[model samples]
Target: MEQQRAAHSTEAVVGMVAQTFLRDRHQFVGELSQLMRTQLPVLDRDERLRELMEAGTTDNLMEILQFLQNEAGEDDVRAPERALAYARILAQRDVPAAALIRAYRVGQAGFLDTGMRYAIEFGGGGPVTTSAIVHIVNRTSVYIDRVCEQVGVAYEDERDRWSGNRSGLQRQWVTRLLDGTVTDTDAAEQYLRYPLSRGHLGIRAWTGPQLDPATAATVFDQLRTALTTVFGRAHATLVVPVDDHEIRMWLAWPAGTAVDSGAIARALTARGVPVRVAIGGYGTGLAGFRRTAAQAGRVRRLALLGGDHGARVLAHADVAAVALLAGDIEALREFVADQLGELAVDNERNLWLRETLRVFLAVNRSYAAAATRLAVHRNTVQYRVRQALDMIGPHADVPGGDLYPRLALQATELLGTAVLRPEPDRN
Candidate 1:
């Protein structure tokens, strides 16, 4: 099987052989692994590729593969050379065959953006965390959009005007694709650095009820466009999960970007496609970006529990404390007991009072409304609400009955925040 006939006789070939020979860092050298792949990493069935790609295994090589595959669909080069180049990219990076195949489908994505993060458990990006991750993800997005636009296809402009800086090569690609200046064979053969390194992540989702490979691939390539629309220059590693079941993504935002998950969700939904988005929870670098994506899934699941059906943003800070409660009602109640047991000391402060307060808050500050909503007498509602206020402040209701329960509610709800954790149900 290793027979060599018309094997390429150039640097590309040498890169491929080196990538094919080296194994994992444990087996050989970590620096070598990084260097051989030239950063992007190789992808293929060759054991050499697997070992070489071992470091950035979780990176989105599959997404990149998908992007190149699609581009090849219409690339003027029209030669197998382009695919060969992509394969070379994967080979150079040491990506395993399975991974390379998966990456080839990335071309279908709208686009992806990479963000930065800085956390201990997950990865972190220090102070400039958000900028770093966003830059990586967004830069990739523009590169691909430039490709689509050059190909004379419809591609949306980023809502945010942030395209970091364009590399000369990417700019040339855009020019050649748009101008039809590159030879058909060359255009078809060009797909450099696709599986080059493992820095980028992917954001991919599907629409068709029964997801096919083509549809899935297409959606992923477009994800960049979707992400760039919101996160601007944030570079992202994007991936569409098998089938049309989910949109998996990783990216970061600046310290003060104040991401609007609801807003991002609405935008995808507007496409009238069955789009799903797991906006990475804000953080610094790569690992942090991964954690952000993980958190996004958690928030999306939580939103589902709350009946928000489709795509969503998962904010880490908002979900942090709550996500720790381990997602259990009783666990949350127990936490409440431990933290603010004093609130339950009196009739107005007991479990029942707390429940009444919860129901009240659930219905807003309307006592009659809360009572009606909870199917209880208005007086009963008033009594419970008053007792809750007593726990809040003895004299809080005297002049400011209005503020008493509100304060108590805040104090009481602190314990309720932890019920959002999505770990396996221990209940």
Candidate 2:
């Protein structure tokens, strides 16, 4: 009877600590979300997805807190709706199931740390504290195990359902091709119905979320028609939808046919669709297909990062240097600031100077050529180049002279507002 009373007392103390955490649930959830993002960078990819993950985290935490507060039996436990939804979304995004499982494990560690800290504070570091900590550990472990099982099931179900469909099959093949996992070219060609031996140009086309689904579909269709018209209908083309707003396409031409990316861009522009397109260089066979697709993907990422400064149609060859630097954006931004100094400022005057200097340098410092490109007089090009040099300070005088400054200018040109200093807010 005495032992039973001691056990009951520990349970009550655990409930009290849980109540304290529940009252400050928002703070705990915020910390847990940050921890998850830090440990698993994939969770930080999309704002909407991050928000969903937060909601699911909140729901899961609340359920666990409630279970602790009421001393609820294991039979009463179940995974929350939001948590299941998050699992399904992860699966749809092609996130590995291991990531989903790792999130729960990370969350469990964070919660346990918080719970242990609160237990000592609530119990004043005594036998009661020890008992409460033990109870919290045992209960939390069981809770995580049960929730993970349910979520894992949801993830697998969604993965299987998603991959069983036609688009999913296409995505699978494309993924295999891109990753260089497909060894049998004949089998892949048979499945995709697009020739693998011909010259291939990969394309990525997407639009902002502002377009409704029907309109986006129409725009994509127009994009397809434009491609066929420019590349000729005789060539085999394969279009695979990456998501509701984006697609991955490959245009295959007869071996040795030169691909005119400029013509393709003009065609897309003439169509006037809201879609933004990225194209990769022509490659022949499986190696070329993979290389071109990878390049297009990198260009797409660079374009997205470029935001308002990105062109409607971008080719990988044009921005290959910038694409290499896009992966570590913070470092690139820092380098831009370091190299250009005050000229990196995103005001009108600075922008004018930067462009003039960039053109002047591009033409081997020929004032006449720079003037022709800028549609300004030779004097204006010379004057702007001097002013840009002054603004850039001594950093522009590196050992290689124009080499470093040229790279910074190209980054500024391609990235636009992304690498430039923001105009200060007067408000």
Candidate 3:
């Protein structure tokens, strides 16, 4: 008899809770919306979030009411199923699960408050009433915890699947083109909407750390704008999001249009963020597109490896010799030592002498021209040249034995030596 009485009281209280929820559902959702605005600014500005919150809150209340009225088993799965749908919707709209989870928590509090108000106003404050109210709150709390867990798992799975689909499709086309397996040029050009016959300037831009979707989109937008400014506003541009941290772009222009790599470099460096941009020389035709993209990728790798730490923009043409030598570090190191000899010591005095000698060779051993370029007297140029020859032996002579030394010194200046290498400032 006591157990029967307890069951009857529980049913009555649950009926009252259901009645109160139905009466105040609008107000309940409104209160949830208010809480969202205060705690989650992103959802406050989103219409999808508003609809999702209202629907999810209503679902939870109805599910709990049904469970209580029917004495339904705990494993009915309605609550978790609704939560999974809510998660899929949120993922589709690109809303973070944190916001939805927070919304659920806030809505749970509001639901409990409504039930408590009904317990006081409809049932009065008695021992049985207190027990029923506590029981209702505990059950509702457990249900919400289960719902949140289900939603989190669903959201993560859906988000990964969506991202994988997008990247997989993009990767297929890009990889095919890169590997030179695209047999139908017309179909490929039509799909990409880029001219296969025109020249292509490939660029790869990336940040050090992975970026959130919103931030990555913003960064890519800025990069596109900078490209338009350098290339042309009307140029056909192809952008491929390689991943969360990297983007590859190709700007197609006419055959005769000149691309100023230096100007593009300046714009990227002034972007007020730590970005590394690699620019590949313009190539004509379908073959050119792949070649340039490959070059940009190499330059980006070198930049990421601290070889170009101080360089904001690296051009393949400028780093061609260094890139070739980078494959064999030991050989390059030995070559630098042999070429610069004592001058490769990385001291200020040695650097000065090396610079004079480089300029002297650059102008066909014209001491007067090197002096004019260096803004020093001709005799000073002559003195440095004689000193450089002494340090490097007869190999420093121009037009005969100096070719390799000149090339190595140029490589050292471009890519720095293996030890005490110079950081790339701006390429």
Per-candidate TM-score against the hidden true structure: 0.33, 0.67, 0.54
Taking every candidate in turn, the Cα RMSD to the unseen true structure, in Å, is 21.1, 7.6, 18.3
Count of clashes, each model: 99, 0, 0
Q: Considering TM-score, which of the candidate structures 1 and 3 is the better prediction for this target? A: 3
Q: Which ten residues in a row have the lowest lDDT in candidate 2?
A: 1-10
Model 3: residues with Cα > 4 Å off, grouped in runs: 1-168, 210-213, 270-273, 301-308, 363-383, 417-427
lDDT of 1 by residue, 104-189 (tens): 22422312211111111122223333333343354345444443332221111110111222332343443343244655524422
**Local distance difference test, per candidate?**
0.41, 0.83, 0.71
Give me the displacement of residue 425 in model 2, in angstroms.
Answer: 9.9
Reference-based lDDT, residue 75, model 3: 59
For lDDT, candidate 2 versus 3, the one ahead is 2
For model 2 the local lDDT of residue 400 reads 61
Clashes in candidate 2: how many? 0
Question: Candidate 2: which pairs clash?
Answer: none
